[model samples]
Target: MPNAPAADQRRLLDVQALDTRLDQLAHRRRTLPELARIAELESQLADLHTALVTSQTAVADLRRELAKAEADVQQVRDRAARNQARLDAGQGSAKDLQALQHELESLAKRQGDLEEVELEVMERLEAHEAALAEVTAAHTQLVDGKVQVESERDAAFAQIDAEVAGVQSERATAAAGLDAGLTALYDRLRGQLGGQGAAALRGRRCEGCRLELNPLDLDAIKAKPEDAVVRCEECGRILVLLPEDH
Candidate 1:
């Protein structure tokens, strides 16, 4: 087994590296741009569906109105025909005939009004149908777009998962080579220090906290044994010295 302090430092470094990689993977998983686009597309699709439904309902209402108007015109024409036959038969008094003519004229006017209403309703129905076609086209486009976006998002997640799996395997291998006490200390320190237990010391600066060490601190670190573990005063992270050439 490695000495307690050296082993702890090594294990802490390994854990820090693994944790950094894990954080990167988690961030990639959560911040995919495609996911935001997918949500937007879904919302747009929902709105389009609502509009299409409303347009279809309007079209149905117009069709009903057209049918009713046609029926009314037919009923009026039938009444006019009956009135004309009664006037021609001369079986009614003059007053009765005059009333029948007035009624027939009223029926003609009502038939014309009903025909005009039917035409208007038909025109409105045609417009609604056109609008529905446009909505259906837009909906189809959105559906296809959503499918493509989802596929892209899934592919990105799959790639990230594979990377995470590889990183985990490497972490396991690294952990296996470390002493148990070192691993325990590393885990404890990492838990206490926001997932970071080790950092590199460059020149007289602590990379963990980006703070320069005082002259006394630098001298003390330099005086320590080559294999001794040192910690950063500012950040409480284990400091690893770089080689002279680095």
Candidate 2:
């Protein structure tokens, strides 16, 4: 059997591997592209809603103006009819009759002006209605896009979570099989080494820092006992040697 220190070193390496995988899963969850797209869609939707409200308000104001103008025209016509009846009944002096006729002519002109204003208001209402329709269409498209993106994002997160859960379960099992003292040492070293407590030495290189070992360091590691755990001088990471066959 390997010495206690060598066994602890192996367990630390396994823990490091699991930690790396956890970091990757966390990064994937945090930086999803679909989430950014969803934020953009929501902003556009809010702008569309504001534009729609403004356009509808304009339409309502135009309608109100048109109704008021039509009412004023009807009132002027009624006044003119009353003046005509008074003239036919011979109830006014000649000068008064002339004044009434002049007033009737002025009222007719005013009615024409009101009708022109009403027409202009109706044109504006039509333009606002057209703009509202366009905004509504755009809003609908964005809503549909948001729905699709949300569904895809949810599914992606769910899959990532499932993978993380499975890996965590396996890591727990591995931990259970390790010696208690070894596990404690690994946990302490992991905290001290910025989450990476162990590393593999491949081809005279430290995998953690990707740095090649100096001649002296190589000689020192070579002279160490087989079951004597050793650390990389440069990176302070437990360095595992390759098997004899590979």
Candidate 3:
């Protein structure tokens, strides 16, 4: 058995209380609601970014298609206009003039067909542009939401950190000047038993495990000298005996 001054044994209980508070604070930090919300927002942003890129690419490809269609229509119009001007000037023999008239008719038909293709490409391009705009707006909204959430999360972190620092200072003070051998034993047991190295023995109960000691065990513990360190059989934790009036 280990020995410690009874006063040091009582002070161990104070250290245990402070240590438990620190553990609780750490757990709170890990499980904060802001952390979960941030993760969810990040996932949504990733998927939205992919969609935004796809919309932009589609709009660019359609704009290039429309440009080609417009060029094709303009080329046919220019050719038809030149043919009509030559026919009006009457600068060729009858056979040549008749051939010119026939060629002008063919060019007019070609221009109409090219115009139809250009109209179709323009319509497709307009629809894609609208789609791209809508996607861009949605992406911007989500980005703003993420920034707001991040700010809130940062504020929460600052509050929790301040509390943790305060608790750590108190724990250090509580553990100071404690018996070296008892402190070592307590630290070792805490590492082994879920952050709880010592608990009070109230009446016939072992507070560490919340179990009632058998009469024989209770009497044996009571018979031990006050300075003799005692452990509970139920939980193997150091048990500090309190005064009856306490």
Candidate topping TM-score: 3
lDDT of each: 0.82, 0.79, 0.89
Superposed by TM-score, candidate 2 places the C-alpha of residue 120 at a distance from the truth, in angstroms, of 0.6
lDDT of 1 at 182: 55
lDDT of 2 by residue, 137-230 (tens): 8888999999999999999999999999988987886666665655665567678887777788887899988999997788888777766666
Clashing residue pairs found in predicted model 1: none
Candidate 1 vs 2: which has more TM-score: 1
List ranges where model 1 is wrong by over 4 Å.
Answer: 1-8, 78-103, 188-194, 222-229, 242-246
lDDT score at residue 143, model 1, on the 0-100 scale? 97
Q: Which regions of candidate 3 fall more than 4 Å away from where they truly are?
A: 88-100
Q: Could you tell which candidate, 2 or 3, scores higher by lDDT?
A: 3
lDDT of 3 at 20: 92
Ranking by lDDT: 3, 1, 2
